[model samples]
Target: MTLKATKTWFLRLLPVVLFFICYYCSQIYFDSYGSSGKSPKTTVSLCDINSSQRKWSSLHLNTSRHPELFLKLEDFFWREHLSNHSLPYGIKGSELLLLKVLAVVTSYSMPGNVESSLDCRTCVVIGNSFTVKNSSLGEIINKYNVVIRLNDAPVRGFEEDVGNKTTLRLFYPESASYNPGKHNDPDTLLVLVPFKQQDLLWLKEILYNEKRVRKGFWKPPPQIWLGRFSQIRVLDPYFLHLTASNLLKIPLNPRRQQKPVHPTTGILAVFVALNYCDVVHLAGFGYPENRNQQQPIHYYGQDTMKSMKNSFHDLNLEARVLKRLEEQGVILHLHS
Candidate 1:
């Protein structure tokens, strides 16, 4: 064969070769790091994760926290999404309808295999912060393999900056609302991050009995507003714990009186992409230490501070983690 023919054949076969290479390396990581019970936590730096510094091997591995998975009521609700806090795992909290709802929803899960793919995928995780307001990342943000938005923020008016596309939108019970005015992409995934059992129950009522849950609304207030175009997935509680323990590596200091908070929606979403995608990008996520601390948290809203002052969610710690990951070249961090 001519040299040109050889080059063409090699290029055509390259994807198949890369897939096996990635698969073989992944098995190694799962064996040595996972089953041996060695520390998954690493003080990674950009120098370490950069492909030029090494190879794609740094990106593949068993960042998967555990081999076994759990998805049952008595098992699931016990896992904490809130800061070291758990929900009362019984039906005694003042409603029976809620109990019936759990019995149904708890049976469904996102499934470990559902998010996996053999091809390379890029993901962009969008946070609700003012840093994104005028950064003009909308066009770039929408082009990723997947785009995830936290809670609910407006995309219509801010499309130039925040991007009008959303692949996934995550909502906790308190933050979960069906925005009547915002654009809802029919294919977007509505993921409910269960802070408590009530959040799960509330989601069920809204999606199923839209009218009875709320009166005379054309669509349920914030429930089933997506209609036929969307679906719901609850974040696994165990996965939430792993990001805190492994990635964020929350300080173990006992002298600190306040308990460490659970991972924020933004961080959890980043970890989700890391598990599934070949590369991940984080936009509008830096702390305002260099700017006014009292500025708005989101570009779309002036009703909040640049960074919240609360123990429920440790915004400061999260900033540091993302910075370290960026330095390590694990993620492309867009803080402007």
Candidate 2:
């Protein structure tokens, strides 16, 4: 045969030859080892060391066969430990002993596994709505270590808004008012949740109103508000206080600040509490969970017509997020 013809014949047989070589190598590997050299899974399995000695030998085989397999397995387990949900501290004012017992029971009983420790607990309560007024949520609200409130959240006529308690009050400078009387105390934990870039200017305008300050509406100066909170903390603005899915970005509704005003701020506070707190009991947040529940969904002093419709949406969001976190063993939702 000519050289060209011979080359063609070799090319046609090359694939078949390579296939057999691979097949033979695989057979040799399996027959000599008797098992694949892979690490065991995390699940517990029953086995007798004596009876399964041969099986173990085959499974381990030569270290060279699965070089980093053991290390990789260890890494996997370590990741799980790092991601495991564990709260070291109790909610807040409640006795740590109460949480310790509950933590022990819930860790094993809950659907998802949780680390047994009360040290990781954190609670953030967010709404600035008038809904909390006079409902007597203050004593309960004070139980949380971290309390986050939004713009113009005051405890004056709306006793529930202030809850007679506040750890952190986040608001735009513009929304803060000192007209008739200072709604919040100088000692109150105040945070500035900025909105429009211009809103900061508006905040400054309100806070820095020398006239208002002299009128006794603001006992502490504008510089004083910043000075006081600066000593405490400035939490990241986007640090959601709850479980919000990153799967989809919630679009900002045009009328969000207008009608159907669902309070993302309120929902976020509860969400944060779920991730970090062990036993989360809500207050002032109305009963949209069941229509038959005695309490109305909103705090009393609200513009009943406008706030009622919007408040329901916010309440629903809270209920849904609470349900999901409960399933994850992150929190025990106390729905009253």
Candidate 3:
């Protein structure tokens, strides 16, 4: 071949070689710094895929009945500047850390139409109330399409009353189950209810195993979380905000002399289920009518109502809300 012909071939392939090299380098850079740097634009598109798959029934369409349930990826960055004195139920200084967590955790959405009836999606929120001990409600609870349980509740020995299936188990870092496998099914989505900035930090550390934080929690959190990263979900603070602000009519940030109030995990679970499921049910959700009586608050533990005196939640107010909901047929309260 002529020398000029060889030079022509080299010129033709130069652009192709450069293109491949650039592509490889970009992939490496993104894989390393994607979560730490600016939040990904793909977050919005990912949530949009399943955001509006189901339409609210006529009952839920009533303005008074429904509230925005889940927080989209856009919520973290766009709304960070908003005033959120209610630290536990709002994102303020922890937006970037939360973005990192969101990048790794899975987005939860309802499954696509599997049933013939559109309004057939049923959910049961199982509380830890002691009344459920001998309820024999296990079979009935398992029949629902979604069974949501709260904070570290055991299901192994009490399966006869609480059922074995768990679609979503909502808990905070301190309340997370040590034996997650024994309490939750393999596919159960573990939802985190971040009450403070440290909660988000705990999730990030446990999910990535980057660092261990020993302080900032009311109770010690699990040093080693046994659940899979894919199963972890950050419950949108919007539901907590709604329950506190709208349902309970509590102030987000009260005056210095006023005590701070927040919704309990059980109430938050009900609000979460309301937006996602067509039919919502409650089990094991009432305090003893006679506070003077010596009755345990939870089915599994010996903790009594006296333990609730210094609690951030108002059990009496929450009970009133639940009773109204039951009377309105917004939720079915099951008695075992």
Candidate 4:
């Protein structure tokens, strides 16, 4: 209970305090410090699809036999598609109506027969991260014809305003499906990105449900958004079932291909837009490094450190692909 006793207690606590400091700093170092030894691929554009218009009826009217649509129609019972609303937000109504209008318009306006058709176009992938905050990247990303967004990362609420040209919502069957009032729309192409084989089976079941699907009794009517929403229209369904570790040619298996795996649902949506559109842009990615000191924003509304640790590898991979595309002169990589 004297000076010597106090000194002994202080000595014991000092090491513990130092250990905690070391751990916290280590996390910060890994999260903020750039990786060394490995070179980063230069981020660039992947394709260019010039914007144009075409006849809506011809483009949208004859969609009766599309295999994907038919297969999906027989699966999920078309529940989500039938209950669409017209609002700019929400999953069921006006949002979907607008998407149908855009799809019909896009379908009607066929691409001209040119070499550019084979080229990937520009697309904007939207995320709810805090990285783009106050950075003024919105105008830059809005240049793309297609804009893909994930859950509700409010543009107005955040610094980078979400553009009006939202083309799709990369959804999954289970917990990832669109929420009723979370500022989503039926017109937002319901891109069901399954992470497993079971997920796909579940989606198929939903599309085929008669009571759920508005017109599941027969083929979905042409020009109606219901069929397309229920149908899987994105890339290879199996591709979504794989993770970045397997897709990006990472060394999960020593004998597998070294090429990068396909992008995640969010990234794939951007690529799909690139495949069909002309220009692409990226926004709301990475971390601000000083997020805690700033306003309430999140890279994904999750713990920043945790999210970064999980996504760092994938983001690095995506950057590599973008850089490669840039090198090929597929598209421009704008930094803001």
Candidate 5:
């Protein structure tokens, strides 16, 4: 081709070259920016893909008759409460043996009850969904007696959308991180959801980093270490299973009930909040599919901009459950 022909071709591809240059530079810039800078270290390619597809047998959901299901059980994490009667599924033999030993090291301690418990109480469960962005719910959210936030959704920067007061923060080993200075509140209780014995093992490591301990089910990166948290509590597996079956209406396998879906942290938080407070409120939950299916998954990270749904947690169905409770005056469904 002649020089004139080559010049014309270069002009046509100029925008394409500039676009690639900008995209590459942005990735480099964002990759090293801040704490929400890089995605939480995970075995999965991404952090949100942390759900395990364990083939659990179906569990019955005939729990509406039991009002006591919401209250704390006796000797919760102290004993391996692995009996199938306590839970629909029995703890596997090896995990049972491990947790039985783990129980020796574990102790249950509740956060000292404040005067607020005796007062007329209202609690709110805040999720990390992007729907709450630009929502002026901060002032109203703070008015509640208790506010529970999930994982590492920061309030310092995004206080307007999510409230500043964090009474409780619920998370698990995979999703939880220890940032020393950010959430330095003695009042905020950090609750751990021990999905398995490995979770307990993992917590032992994070809280009190030991060398040459027996192997646990979960093996996160060696660099995983926790900062100071004022209070820490392990959730009894029975409580989560109870939530999955009863409040969520998940039925036993081979029965005409909702599938025994694993309750997400948000689902568990909703249950926990409802029991403690006279009325509960839920914010930033149930992926807003109608408005924007392509919005960022969490308020903190803008990397994964897409819908939040998975086979493991039926968030939509969970949302429906919350709505039903709202109609029954059990809770208030705070929407964006």
Candidate 6:
């Protein structure tokens, strides 16, 4: 070949080679830092890439295999039967009313399997404990594949400590946020943990925009819930049963004298995450170390530990179970 011809061929191939090199580098970059140059909002992190082989605790293995996370049409009759027997801390709504609400909300039921592009699915349960107020865990909490917040914990101004990314916010009617939009993302699932027949009634009224009921709830629920119906999910009563009976060792049907112990939203949220996540984490849990400590129970509210005396939850027992979970490698606590 002529020298001039050889030079022409080299020049033609140079552009093509450079294009391939740039494309390959770009792919590598996105894989590491994601498309937006940050950890992905809902996928395995680099540190947890190989976490699939890790052995989960017995608590996770026992409950994770169950397919139903939320109440569905199929379980209506069974739930109704259980409710008729005076089951404590379980939904006692009429079968007809319960069926109607389940039909609307269960359409958005969680998938039986954990959905993730990668093997390791990370989750964080953000509690309302005041300990998280200055923990500076916002960036860390936001990195998980799932961020589950409990009750009415506000995330607007506390984003610096409690990341604003919430995949699920679990609450009963009494604890539901008045302004859910300010605390939840556009796609956050509003999971209702019904403690009584009235709770389901309240949800039905809220979803259908029926006349608001000012009675039944210990405290008044939101008069108008602005969230979309598709964003709602009713937690399966089985979780409430499991958390109360197995985890907390509380009786399903307490006698009249026993002030009716039930699982708190924080611990219940952790149980939900265990079923759907590979590595579960907890933030802002634990109560004031002592009765006289004068520490606020919640991050945003001025209410202190004294307020817990009137509550149905036994916070001391919940704290112990959480500690055991941390020790067993089932979950990691984010706050000191």
How many clashing pairs per prediction, in order? 9, 21, 0, 46, 4, 0
Q: Write the per-residue lDDT of candidate 1 for residues 90-169, one digit (tens) a residue.
A: 22232344445445553344333334642545677888777787887777776666778887676788888878878777
lDDT of 6 by residue, 180-293 (tens): 888888878888887787788888888777998889878888898777788888877777777787778888777888777788888888877776677787889878876664
* Model 3: per-residue Cα lDDT over 204-243, one tens digit each: 8887888788899888999898988767777777677767
Candidate 4's residue-wise lDDT over 131-188, tens digit each? 5556656554555545677644544444355554455556544334334223443345
- Model 2, stretches more than 4 Å misplaced? 1-137, 150-163, 173-186, 204-235, 240-249, 252-263, 272-280, 287-297, 308-318, 327-329, 332-336
Better of 2 and 3 by lDDT: 3
Steric clash count of candidate 5:
4
Question: Candidate 6: misplaced stretches above 4 Å?
Answer: 1-57, 60-64, 79-93, 111-117
Point out the higher-scoring one by lDDT: 1 or 2. 1
**Window of ten residues with lowest summed lDDT in model 6:** 80-89
C-alpha lDDT values of all predictions:
0.60, 0.38, 0.76, 0.43, 0.58, 0.76
Model 5 residue 62 lDDT score = 41
What is the clash tally of candidate 2? 21
What local lDDT does model 4 show for residue 146? Answer: 54
- Predicted structure 2: lDDT: 0.38
RMSD of candidates 1 onward, in order: 12.7, 26.6, 19.8, 20.3, 18.4, 6.6
Q: Return the TM-score for candidate 4, rounded to 2 decimals.
A: 0.46
Deviation of model 4 at 286, angstroms:
3.2
Report model 5's TM-score to 2 decimal places.
Answer: 0.64
